[model samples]
Target chain A: MADTVLEVRDLSLEYRSRRGPVKALRNVSFDLYKGETLALIGESGCGKSTMGFALIRLTPGTAKITNGNVTFVDGPNRINLMEMSENEIRRFRWTDMAMMLQAALNAYNPLIRIQDHFIDTAKAHGLNNKSEIIARARRLLTGVQLDADRVLPAYPHELSGGMRQRVLLALGLLMQPKIIILDEPTTALDILTQRSIIELLRKLKDEFNFTMIFISHDLSLAAELADRVATMYAGQIVELTDVFSAFEKPRHPYTFGLTRAVPTLHGAVEKLESIPGSPPDLVFMPSGCKFHPRCPFATDKCKEVEPKLTAYGGHQVACHNWQQVLEESQKAR
Target chain B: MALLELKHITKQFRQGKKVVTAVDDVNLAIQDKEIICLVGESGCGKTTTGKMAAGLLDQTSGQILFEGKDISKLSGPEFMAYRRSVQMVHQDPFSSLNPVRTIYQTISAPLLYHKFAKDERDARRRSIEILEMVDLTPAEEILDKFPHQLSGGQRQRVSVARALTVNPKFIVADEAVSMVDVSIRASLLNMLRRLNQELGVSFLFITHDLALAKYFAWEGRVGVMYTGRMVELSRSPSLIEKPLHPYTAALMSAIPEADPRLTRSKERIVLRSDDIPSLTKLPPGCHFHPRCPVWLEGKCDKVQPILTEMGPGHQVACHVAFDITGGGSKISAGTR
Candidate 1:
């Protein structure tokens, strides 16, 4: 069996706004194996990005990890990121883990040259040689299929959206980190550029053998790139399984609903059956199960008692009536 | 009959000392009740073309003919009638709708402006009907609620309802579902599809995603653009199955298959050094020859290819594409 690179146990996070306390993530637990791609997928505001932030201990403004242990496994040493000092975390970041955000097009400093972004990153990580940094930047830029000379001196606005995204990718690889957190890295890009970026990312992961955490609101996209998939709803992981199983034999009602809702590129055109209601507001979350309000198979029991994610035949699902949901869907079919 | 036809239309904009041709010479025709999807990247002028076709913007040169009559000089009742015949659905549901305006007011504004209703009560009743048409049910509940209170999907439905309130024969949906979430996107797309089927409304659906364009307009035609020029036009299946232009092939190759196994085993064309050409300084000859994978040495660099028909209702603009597929000797661009 492959070793676990990172383990998030009973992870709970919340943000205190003027409105109230909003639970961004609730008891989220998962294991990221070495050299594996883990996809966290859900609707917008489903806390997938929140989980990414919490894992790296960079939960944004006013957000606090109320409960949980995010342990980063390094060889034999287990580092609990939550307990690490600010200085320690800062040192650990980029060198140990790097993040390519959703709006990566705007990630670069618009006024500065692309080479300056690379050099600044390298110098921060203690690479003092200017020639070495320039050479390294050239190599990385070439790896992402960009002309090093043409792009290095150009400002962010000078490069195309695809080229700018490539610069961000090269920046993410500056330190050769063990883990890469890609939060919708290709969301705004065109399909051609998006495909090439994904291909390049997958190729880089294979070449470097680094773990990847892909956070997207697209399930089909998640299925295309990830080995394992975690379906998040509201703030909890409703289902977690391998990509094949998650797509082929989803146990949770939300997963089933999602599989039917997305339009497909291949196979017959299936009418998209949208889940009736919208995702619940985080501030005024539903009583028991957060997804209960929108779930078609929701019952009185589901409305009162929250279901914990439990393992069944190597897959984890948080649903009170998976069996009934299956039977009812089967009967309807 | 063709409801609208764009004959050799061109749009240019001035930027400092540079004059950028946002849309080059193009031709397209939208038949009554037919959905024609315009697929391209950001700078490819798909949105601008849609805006021109909707009468929201005017073309700099050439002619825009609606029902075989020029629309450029439309005045008085003709311009007012044209406005009612065409409508637009913008991309962002968040900013498109007025946050302070209730669904009723937002939908009824156009009807009230054009005097489509007898009075306020009559206007609201028709707005409710349009709301129900786009699947916003219990219309009374949504009618009074402000835009902020509704979900993204609901807001998009409201926008569609507003467009429908004018009883427009055509709609220019500019990236309409791109801002909405994936699960909600389908419902909106289906609603658009339903409108096309049931209401017989022509659509100039503009978007960057070809898969979505194909999904919504399966039976209709798709036009592929590159650097403000329509490179290929064909029925949806043919375009997806046997795309002729190199750019179309690149775009098609970029689509992520839903199946992981298929994607893993699939061979994708990752272009080498794709620097999107500037609108003001497009390269000589083919606009895409710079990044094309199978570009001809001297021919593709010097000769600008025109949109040439290769099969029934299918057209492509590339010199060596046919030769690569051994279709070079079979047929010429003019034979169709």
Candidate 2:
């Protein structure tokens, strides 16, 4: 509904393995709207993190983007990231977009003070005035509810896990980028710490109005943060819809199964039904639908024909038997 | 009689010059086929308590009784028997399984050592039976594969199978399913529940996830720990619904539910501080007092509170909770 800030068209990537190419992403297409949080939710090895890395063109050496066009649009200027030179992309990275990686402890150098990380990032983005950089970093540290005085001078190991995560968040916002991608930011933190971080993110989003792509396996975080959710399974976008529709009326069976698998903290304890099988191997994938091996409503057609992501009403789902899935999900409620 | 019991369990570790009390004055008794989940944040001593229960680590001051005999005082054969009856399933399936050993070699070693199987042929048969019991299908195919060949869930099942090799009466599963995928977690928990039901093996399950604790130990009991103390212990469903301790209530209110509407609308208990204090420099009196929302100034900071019975089968350790719950009728008598 809002302005489209980034468009990914037919994006596909693969990892060069000893056996063969591991198809990590397959024909994934999506539009990221300005000032909206789009959550990429999936289990492990579902290419959610790969999608993040691919967006910034910072994928590992073994990863090769085979086919894709990533266009970044701001006002009248349209720039295809795939066409950018290595030097140009480096200059465009922190100023236009930034990615906060997982495990903040590992993100920072153990020997350096927190201020150095901020200063180095700012300098790389061509901001050489040391005092100005320190002032901005202090402001962000305080904005994240950390004591700027104590945190700015301490090493990464000296700070707690939650504090380190907050520092990383502050550093991501140091250049004041319009788009930020966070990968499993709160995975290992305590519940109270997670709540505080969620609250802080909400506050930051309201104040800054920056577009965010949150990558996490935790469904509750996605439910609390995202405007729209894309369920990734076996290196493909299986379902894409509004957060409400994604949870209340998930059309794809894998999305439905994921919503049912997690137990809620406050609710009637119902018998949870887990997805029947494990995720498919990326190198030697099964034919037809990637999720067909675990789908209860899978038919003979599903085994032979690959279903494309088709729009029905307002949402998109890649499933042949979605009507039956909708009916059964409604009945379960 | 209880199958296993830990009385006044206290574990202290010497780190450089300072002595860190990892677990302090904890008491628990698990009966036959009972499931008691210990839920807490990291550095809260849940794992240390579990290791003590499994006899993997010795408690500095405590009594671990297996079949009414103290484990520390047991003779060589008696200690071996105690070790056989109690097993541990660690958190990381990747590192817990020996990388070099094949699945058959790892599982059969315990069977042959404890003489659960008569010979090598018998050991192979028993290993397959145990692997099949944990639902690792095509057991014959899996036996020859090394740990790296299996998925995380498969490796965890192998771990469970290895724990089951000795036919343990009590298994201490410390965050057993945390490392697996969300879809796989439920099935693994279901398999563990099935083991509890069919084999009559009790468990001391440990995890930081309250939702998972509620799901796994719904029919059993849940214990809430903070720092190195047991703050609350009660039946699972009630403990989740009507938590008495402030820490437990804070954790319950703070956790985000999977539902969109429920998670957003739920009220939260904001703590005084977010940082969990270090073990070496723990605050005096109650370990949670510094961050407690309902802390008493003079009493809570001056005196530690022991577990007191608030209602039927419910135990809480807090001065404010004790006051709010009518000051209790009796102190917990060290038996669940």
Candidate 3:
């Protein structure tokens, strides 16, 4: 897709807690093209947030980026994020890429005025013209449908949760980064607020044409927003495919279980089929195929042997029996 | 028989000298086998009403009748027994289930406490059976596992199993599926529907997601709440297809359709006010008048609107039901 903007290859993350090393991510690979949203979706502890944090090197002191490479192909520079020095990453971060973290309320400085926070971010990046920066900030705020006057002068506490989120979005867009990563940006908002925020993101993306790496636990929201969907389970991407294909024909059993679990807006009342077991503890993960314990379709081979992600018809699935699962799911329907 | 009936039930909590009326006078009925959905925003009082139904909180006035008996009068063991019959499945499965306890121990505790089984062995057996009913097969393996060992979805299943262990006739699932991932939410919902059909367990499925509610309940009645008041209640399909209340119509429009092709042109109803009016200092007359889109001037501020029947079984509490003056257009109940 026109020289992939960001490429994540075989990314692995580990954390050394008091208990021991917790393997949070394993061989995670994906590519973000310009002007597209790639949704990384899974349950709470499925390492989705871990991946986002790892990308920005925001993981806690206990955590470490153990393996893999993240390559950012900017205009003239092809930078390997992992290999780059701290100073290099600092320069690359706001200019080439930026992140909109979860917990928008806590992300900003409570002591500072909302507009000052934007000014600080812009100034640090060497965009010193106050009027130019202010104008840009106002335009970005307007892009998210927030009144600049009302929001700019107000303190963080004065603004609502949704407005704070819009401010975060505007701040993320201030640098005009090629790639923007959002980690569950709407998780804390109410349903209506989430709807508006998501709608705003969609509209902003269309207007700005920036590549987005959207990470969330809400599969339904992801299915709606993402061009391609990736389902993560215990440190690995289990299924990756186009949104329509993933929903219509999910190959991975874990993905199937996830889809079956989500309650739809309009349909007959149906029982949510839950995965049989919990996620494996990352500190001492299961021997092979972390999902084996919960998988209804798991066999002796599944427990004894780990499966590699295999590509077929533009979909990548890490399951021993994707063919059988696809057939069985079809038959059930 | 209807397992529980909430007749104009309201609750007001006293904070210092101020009184915060959390639940406004609202009417609802829970039949023996029907899953009634109470959908609304955060401060809508669905949880307060559920707590009242479970006898966890005392209603300010009005009646909370269980099996035609007023539960407010029930005391001590009688109240405890009433609590046993109405089980609440909370939003966070992880926090709800004790982390240190085994699945069997957690599930069997209720059965043992209520003296449902003769002995510990029987309780264990019954617990396993309930687990199996929720599709946690090879129940023996799951029995010994602690809450931390279970996945979010599995933990939620254990929560359901524990609730069912008491063999409650009515279950109040307050955002039961909200915390879990969407892929597994449908399956859990399907299991609940099965319990309703097979065991005749009535459910009060409370959530903010109207779409999820529509998919999980049958012959279901939907109540829309706004600012601690039951704004609208109607048959599920009717509520979705033709929402009578302006609030309900606005909420329906807010839902992002999964199919982007089905584009709706409805103007997004962004509530102008940031904070909900503290119940302690609520506006006069209609509680929702301050925030309502269709609110009229003196009519909404001076007079409280009773929930009048708009059609067969359809009820709405709004002073400007027929006004349709504000928000730039009129939304007739017939068009909804």
Among the numbered candidates, top TM-score falls to: 2
Which regions of candidate 3 deviate over 4 angstroms? Answer: A17-20, A127-136, A267-272, A281-307, A310-313, A319-333, B14-18, B75-77, B98-113, B117-146, B257-304, B318-336
Q: Which ten residues in a row have the lowest lDDT in candidate 3 chain A?
A: A263-272
Clashes of each: 0, 0, 27
Per-residue lDDT tens digits of candidate 3, residues B91-151?
A: 8997998888898889888888889877999988888888999988789999999998777
Which prediction has more favorable DockQ, 1 or 3?
Answer: 1
Candidate 1, B117-139: lDDT as tens digits: 98999998898888899989889
Docking class of 2: high
lDDT of 2 by residue, B106-152 (tens): 99999998999999999999999999999998999999999999999
Q: lDDT score, residue A246, model 3?
A: 76
In terms of lDDT, model 3 sits at 0.81
Candidate structures ordered by TM-score, highest first: 2, 1, 3
lDDT of 2 at A274: 83
* DockQ per candidate, 2 decimals: 0.66, 0.82, 0.42
lDDT scores of the candidates, listed in order:
0.84, 0.91, 0.81
Model 2 chain B weakest lDDT span, ten residues long: B327-336
